[model samples]
Target chain A: MDFLIFQIPILMVQASMDGILLGILFALIAYGMALQWGVMNIINIAQGELVILGGYIAYFMYMAGIHPAFGVIVSPIVMYFVGWGLYKTIIFRVVDRDLFISILATFGISILTQQLMNFVFGSDVVVAQSNFGTTMLFNSMVTLPNSKIFAAVVSVIFAMLLVLYMRRSKLGRAIRATAQNARAAKILGVDTESVYAATFGINAALCGVAGALIAITFTLHPYVGLPYTVRSFMIVIIAGLGNLPAVALSGMGLGVFEEFSDYILGTEFRIAAVFLLLVLILVYRRFKLARKREYLK
Target chain B: MDLFKKIFSIFAAISFFVSLALPAQAKVEGDTIILGAAVSLTGKYSTNGEHTQNGYNMAVQRINDMGGVTVGGKSYKFDIIYYDDESDSGRAAQLAERLIKQDGVQYMLGPYSSGLTKAMAPVTEENQIPMVEANGASRSLFTKGYKYLFAVLSAANQYLEVAIDLAVEKNGGNPVNIAMAFEQDAFSQDVRIGVVEAAERTGSTIIIDDKLPKELNDMAATLAKVKATKPDVLVVSGHSKGALTAIRQISEMKVDIPMLAMTHCDASKLAKQHGKNSEYALCAAQWHKTLSYSDSFFGDGQQFDKDFNDMFGYAPPYQAAESAAALLVYKAAFERANSFDKEKVRDALAQTDMQTFYGNIKFNDTGQNIAKPMVLFQVRCEGDVCANRVVAPTKWASHELVHPIPSWSTR
Candidate 1:
C-alpha cells in the first residue's frame, strides 16, 4: 500500500526499460540451456558457472587493455573449446546414464567450477566498463545506459545468427536429427557422439556470449552464477525447448514481472517471486493437463 | 600356528595400550591454551573468512612471539583450532558445540557474519562460554540479553551515526534533508535505525526513503525519486555490493545530488574498483589506520597496519582490524582474570574499559561497544586517480570533508 510506484508513473517506464534490457540478456542464456536440453537430453546445473567463466574471460581481456565489447565475439570461441573438452572428459560419461546421474554430475561440476573461478578471479565482484554513456528520454525522467542498449543489440544479433546456423548448416541438420532420434541417427551413419558434443559446445558458446554481455552491463560474482542458472532454467521451462520466439517473449515477460514485483513487493522478494512464479506456472499447467487424465507425476 | 596367534595377540594389545596412553597425555597435559573458531573457509563468506583467519593467525603469532599469556605460575602459548562451517549457520552451531564438548576448547572467537554468529550464540550461551566476536553487528543479537556474547566491533546501529554527526556539524547545527535507500538485510536495517535516529537528533527531514533492489541491482527508481526530491544529503545503507551498484547508477544517471554517504564503503576499495565516480562519497568506519590508538601488545595504529600488511600482503580493512582486536580483548580478559576459567573471563570482559590500536573498547550493559567512535573517510579523486582521505573529527581528519558535492557537469 505504501508503494511509490503509484506516485511516479515514470518509474514504470524506467523499470520496464531496465527489465526488458535485462531480459534480453536472460533470453540469451536461456537459449543456450534450451539447446543442450533439446539435443543432449541433459540438464546442466553448471550452466551458470559456465556463464561466469565466460564473463571472467572478458574481464581478463579488459584488464589486459582490450575493450570488453570484443569479448562478445572472443568468449564464445574460447568457451566452445572449453565446452568440447568438458564433454569429452566428464559429460560424455554421463550422457548415456540416468537423467538423475547427469544432474548429480553437473551439480558437482557447478561447485567445482564455482570454486575454480573464485580462486582464479580472486572472489571479487567485478564489472567490465564499457563507458558507453547514457540515453535520456521522457524529458530526462527515464535514463537508460548505452551499455544495456548495446547488450540487447548484440544478443539479438547472436540469436539470429544462431538460428541461421541451426537451420542451414550441415552439422546443424545432423544435430537436429540427433535431437529427433539419437539411436536412429546413429544407425544412418550420423556420428551421434560428435553431435552430442557439438550440441553441448555450441550451448556453452551461447552462454559465453551472454556472460560477456552480462559482465559489461551488470556485475559479476563467483557465487552469483546460481541465480543466472535458475533464471535460465525458469525461462526454458516457460518458453519450452527449441521455441525461439517464445523464449524471447517469455524472457521479456519475466524481466518485466521482476521489475514490477521489485516495485510492488520490495527488492528482497524478487528472487522469491521468480521461483514462486515458476511454481505457479507449473501447477496451473499440471491441473490443466490433469483434466485429460495426464498428470505431471 | 597356536604360538604365532598368541604372539600376534600380544603385539596388538601392546600397540593399543600405547595409543591410549598417548591420547590421555595429550588431553591432560596443556602446553598451550587453545581457542576455537567455526570460520567459513569454503562458502559465501570465504573471502572475508580468509581475512578473519589471517587476522587471528597474525594476532596469535604476535602474542606467542611476545612470550604468550602468563597466568599466575606458567606461560602457555596461544593456539587455535579452526573448523570450516561452509557459511552454514547449522554447521556453525554444530561445530561450536564440537569445539567445546569434544575438542576441549574453552575460549572462543566468533564467526564472520551476523547470521552465522547468531546461530553459534545459543551454543556459547548454553555452554556458558565467552565469545568475543568481530563481525556480527546486528543490534538484535545483543538485545537478547546473552551474557556470554561480547562483541569487539561497534554494533550495526552505530555504523553510520558518525556520518550524520559530521554532516550536522558541517551544516552549522542546522538540519539537512536526507534520502535513504537501504538494503533490506538485518545489518542494513540496523544501520537504517542508526541513521534515522541520528537524523532525528540532528533535525534532518526524511524527504525520500526506499529499500534498495535485490543484489543492489537496478536501483534507478530509488535514484530517480532521490533526484526528484533534491534532498540536501543522501544516506545509503547497503553492503559493499549495494554501494557499488549505487555508485554505477548514480554515475550513469548524472543525478546532481549534493552529498552522498553510505555504509560499508571502504574508500580504497571503491577507488580501486570505481574510479572518479566514487569521489566525495562519505563512509563511516569502525577503525582506520590513522587513529593513533595503541595498546601494550600492538604498537600504534600505523604500526598495526604495517604489521598486518606485512603479514597478510594487503592493507587490513576494518573487518580484519576488528578481528585482531577481538583477540586483543581476549588477551586482556585472560590476563586480568589470571586464569582460563569461563566465569572469570566473562566477568573480566564485562568490566573491560581499555584502548587498543583499533579504538577505545568499552562494553555497555548490552555488551555493545559504546565508548568507541566511528571514523569518517571520503574518496577523493584527481582527474584519473582516486584515493581515500580520512576527513572528520578534526583529530583524525587527514583531509577536509568535501560537503555538498559539486554538480555532475562541473566535475
Candidate 2:
C-alpha cells in the first residue's frame, strides 16, 4: 500500500526492467528443473545446492584472478559430470521409486551439500566483483548494472543454445522419446538409461550457468540456495514441463511481481509475497482442474 | 524367529548408541569446570558463530595456560561443551534445555545472534544459571527483567545513533533527512529504534525506512527508492549480510548520498572485499584494534588483534573480541567468588566491573555494559588497500571523519 511506486512513475519502468532481467536468469534455472522433472520424473530438492556449487566454482575462478564471467563456460562443463556422477550414485536409485522418496532423498542431499559447502566456503556471503560497471537508462533515473545485463544476455544465449540442441541433437530426440514414455522408448531401441543420465546432466549444467550468473549478479552463501530453488520450482509450475517460451514468460512475470512487491509491499515481505503467489498459483490450478472434472461429470 | 531376533538386535544397537550419545558430565568434574554453550555452528550465522567459538576457545586456552582460575584454595581449568544451534532460535532454546537438564551444565554461554539469546534467556533465568554473553545486543533483551542473562557488549540501540548525531553535526547542526533499512531481527530492529530516536530528537524527517528480510542479498529496489528520493544520510544494519549486500548494490547502482552509515563492516570484511567501492562508509563497532583498552591476559587491543590473527589467520572482528571478553569476565567472576557455588558466581558477576583487551566490562542492572562507548570507524583507503580507521569519540580518533563522501561519478 506504499503508493510511492505509483507516485514516482519511472520506478515502474525500473522495477519492470529489473524484474525481466532477473526473471531470465530464473528461467534458465527453471528450465533445468523442468528437464529433470519431466525426463527422470524425479524432483531434485538439491537443485539449489547444485546452483550454489556452480556459483562457488565461478567464485573460485574470480579468487584465482580470472574473470568470473568466464565461469559461465567452465562451471557448466564441470557440473555436467558432477550431475552424471550424482545420478549414477544416488539419483538412479530414487528415479523409478515413489515421487515422495525422490523428494526425501534429494532433500537429504540438499542438507549434506549445504553442510559440505559451509565447511568448504566458510559460510561467508560472497559475490564475485565483475567490475563491468553500470548502464544508465532514462536520464540515469533507472540504473542497471552492466553485470546484470551480462548475466541476462548469457542466460538467454544459453537457453537458446539448449533449445537448439534439444531440437537438433541425437541425444535430444532420445530424451524427448524417453520423456514421452520410458518403456516405449526402451522398446523402440532408445537407451532410456543414458537418456535419463544425460537429461540430469544437462539440467545440472543449466543450473551451473545460472549459478555463475548469480555469483556475479547477487551475493552467494551456503543457505541462500533454497530461495533460488523455490523460485525456479514456482516458475516451472507456472510454465509447465517442456514449454520453453512459457517458462521464460513466467520467469519474467515472477521477477516483475517480486520487484513490484518489493517496492510497494516493502523488502521484508518480498519472500513472503513470493510464497503467497506460489500458494495462489497452486490453489488456482486446483480449482481449474476441479472445474474440469465437474464439467466431465 | 531368527528374523525377529535380527530386528530386535538392530533396535537394541540403536538404543545403545542413543544412550551413549547423551553427554555424561556435570558442571564441575574433578578440577575442570564445564560451561555449556549453544552457538550457530552450521547455518546463516555460522561465520560469526565460528568467531564466538574461537573466542571462547582462545580464552579457555589462555586462562588454562596461565594457571587456571584459583577458587577456594583449588585451581580449576575451564572446559566448554558446545552444541550447534544451527542459527535457529527454536533449536537454540531446545539445545539450551538439553544442556541444562540432560547434560547437567549449570553455567551457560550465550549464542551468536540476539534472537537466539532472547530464546535461551528464559531457560537460563528459570534455572538461575548466570550466562555471560558477548553478543546478543538487542535493546529488548535489556528491558526484560532477566537476572541470569548478562551481556558483555553495549545494547543494540547504541550501535548507530552516534552516526546520526555526526551527520547532523556535519550538516551545520540542522536536522537532516534520514533513510534507513534494518533487518527484521531483534538486534537490527533495536538499532532501527536507536536511529528513529535520533531522528526524532534532531527533528529530522525520515524519507525511507525499509525492513530487510532475514535472508537478504539483493537490495536494488530499496536503492532505487533511495535514488528517487535522495536523503542526507542512509543508515543500514543487518549483521554481516546486510552490510555486504548494501555496499555491493549501492556501488553497483551508484546511488549517491551525502553520508552512509552501517553496522558489521568488519564482521563482513567490507573494506577487504569491496576495497575502493566501500570507502567513506561509517561503521559502528564495539571495539577496534586501535582502541587503548588493555588487560594482562591479552595486553591491549592491538596485541589481541595480532594474537587473534596469528591464532585464527584472520583479523578478529568485534564479535570475536567481545566473545573473548565474556570468558575473561567469567574468569574474573570465578576468582572473585572464590567458590564453585552458582549463587556466589552469580553474585560475583552482578558486582563485577573490570577491563579486558576488548573493552571495559561494567554491566548495569540490566546486564548491558554501560562503561564502553561504541566506536565509529570509517573505511579509509590508501592506494588499493582499505582498512577501518577510528573516526569518532575524539578520545580514540585515529583519523579525521571525512564528510559528504565523494559521489559515485567522481569516484
Candidate 3:
C-alpha cells in the first residue's frame, strides 16, 4: 500500500474534500433511487441512464450557448415529464410485478436508452464547461474545484427541499401511504396508480439534477452511466430505503473510501474497491441478520 | 389429439435445426467479394468504431466509383458484412469465428481497438484469412508474428516517444522528471511501456506513474500527486475520454507542469470543447491533414480531410484516416495478387508498398507499417478558437513548439 497519503497530511484534506463533494452528488442520485424503490417497490436499473439523460439536457443547453448551471433548473423539469412518460408507457405495466421482472425490464430499457443516446449524441465523451474555477486552501496546497463545491451545495439544497416536500405536500403524503401499504392506500380511496407515476417521475427528476452536476464536474459518456447506477445502488443498500440522512452519510463515506483506496491502491483499483466494498457490505449484513435466524428479503 | 400434438412438436424441432443449417452466401458471390468485420456499434468504442466504419465505407465507395478491383481480367466490387461486437473482446473473437464459419467470409477487416484486434487476430490467423486492420496499434500485436495480419498504422509505442524526447530537448538536454497516467487497457498499457522505455533512454526519472481505470471519469488523485511532486512533464493516454477528463481536471486544479503530452486530443474534440483551457497541450497523432501524403483516389491529405468532413460532417481524426488507408492497402494488394486466392492475397498484403492520403503503407516483417512516422501536434488557440497545429519532426512543423506553457496565474 502507498502510505504517501498518510505522509503528506494535506493530501488527506484534499481527498476528503473531493470525496465528500463527490459523495453529495452520488447521494442525490441515490435519493431518487431510494424514493422509487420505497414507494413503488420497483428497483430501476435505468437510474444511471436517467442521470446521463439529465446531463445530456444540460450539455445541449451548453451547446445552444446557454449556461449549463441553468441545467439544474431546466433538466429536472424536462426529466420529470420524461419520467412520467416512461412510467405511462413502460413502468406502469411492470408495477406490482416481481422485483426480478422489474429489474429485467429496466435493464432492457437501460440498454435501449444507451443505444438511442449513442445514436443521438454521437457517443462522444463530453462535458459542459462551467468555468467556475478552483478554490485554493491552506496557501494553495489543497485545491478544490468551485464547480464541485457548487454541485455539493446544490445537491444538499435539493435533498432538503425534497425532504420538506415529502413531509408537507398532499401528494407526498399519498406517496408515503402507498409505500406503507399499497392495498390499504387503495382501499382508503387513494389513487395508488397516480402515486406510483409521481414517485417514478420524481426519481427521474432527481437523477436529472445529479446528471447535470456531473456534466459540469466530471465527464459524460453514454456507457459510463452503469458506474453511477452501481454507486447509487450500493449507497441505497447501505442506507436502506426511505432513509434520507443515512443515504447522504453513506454516500459521503463511500466517496471518502474511494478516494483513500485510489490513493493507497492506485486508480486501477478504484472501481474494483468500490465493487469490493459492495460485496463486503452484503456479506456482513447477511451474517449479521443470519445470527438471529433471519435473512435479507 | 395427442398424436397431433406430438407431430407438431416434431415439426417445430425440425424447423429450428433447419434454420440453424441455412447456408450463407459464398465468399465471392457473382462479381462481388465479401469481407467481414466486427466493429463496436454500441459500446465504449462506438465513436471510433463509427469512424472506422465510415472510413471503410468511404474507401469502398470511392474504389467502386473509380473502378472495382480487376482479378483475372474480371472486375469485382467490394462489399462488407459487419457485425456489432459490442466492444467486448470475447464477443469480438466469437464474431470473427462466426464470420468465417457461418457467413463464409474468407477475408476480414480488423476491429476498432487494440484489445479487440488482439482478440480477433488469433481467430483470423487460425482460419488462415487475410486481414488488414487500421486501429490496432499495440506493440505486442506486431510482436506476435502473425502471418496473415497486417496493420496500416504505426505501433502504439511510437505514439508518444517523441513527446518525451522533445521534453528532454526543451529542458536543455538534461534528464527531466516525468509523471504519466495511462488507462489499464491493451492500447494504453502499450503506450505506457513506450513512455517507460523513453524515460530510460533519456535518463529521465518518472515521479508519478499511475494506471487509470478503463472507464475513467476523474483523475484528481493522480493530478494531486503530480502537484505534490512538481514533475517537468505530465503524460496521459486513455483514448478520447481520458484526454477530455485530463484537460477538465488539470484546468480545474490548475496543476502546473512544464509540459503536458496526451493522445486522442482531436478524437475527443478537446480543442473545441475545452477551448482555451486545452491550449498548448501537446498530442500524438497518426495522421494530420497538413501532412503532404497523397494518393490518386483521395489526392493529398488536405483534399481527403475536406472530402471526409463533407461526407461525415466532422473532421476525420487520425483513427479514421488510418482506417481509410487500410482499404487502400487492401486494394493495392488485391491488384498485385491478380487473383482471389487467399494465399496469394496474403503474400500481396505482405508486399504492400504504396502511398495514400493517410501515409505510406509499407509493412515490415512483423506486419506493422514502418514507413510512416508518428507526428506530434499542439493545440493552439487564437482568440477563443483552438485548433491542433503540427509542431514536431520539423519536416511538417506548421507552427513552432510552445515550451513551458504559460502558468495559470499569468493566463
The Cα error of candidate 3 at residue B364, in Å, is: 2.3
Clashes of each: 0, 0, 0
Instruction: State the lDDT of candidate 2 residue by residue for B1-411, as single tens digits.
Output: 999999999999998776556544447889999999999998878999999999999999999999999998899999999999999999999999989877878899999988899999999999888999988988888888889888999888999999999999999999999999998977889899999999999999998989988766778899999999999999999877788889988998999999999998988889988899999999999999899989999999899889999999988888899999998999999999998788899989988899888888888898888889999999999999999999998899999998898989899
Best by TM-score: 2
For candidate 2, what is the recovered fraction of reference interface contacts? 0.67
Q: Tell me the spans in candidate 3 whose CA falls farther than 4 Å from its real position.
A: A283-297, B1-33, B67-77, B83-91
Which docking category, incorrect, acceptable, medium or high, applies to candidate 1? acceptable
lDDT of 3 by residue, B1-411 (tens): 999999999999998676566434448899888899999987778888988999999988888888888888888898999999998999999999989987789889999999899999999999899999998998998888899999999999999999999999999999999999999878888889999999999999988888998766889999998888889999999988899999999999999889999999988899998999999999999999999989999999899999999999988888888888888888888889998789999999999889998888898998999999999999999999899999998899999999999899888
Q: Which stretches of candidate 2 lie over 4 Å from their true place?
A: A290-297, B1-31, B88-91
- Among the numbered candidates, top DockQ falls to 3
Instruction: Candidate 1: list runs displaced more than 4 Å.
Output: A283-297, B1-31, B165-177, B199-209, B212-216
lDDT value, residue B208 of candidate 3: 84
Q: TM-score for model 3?
A: 0.93
For candidate 3, list the clashing residue pairs, or say none: none
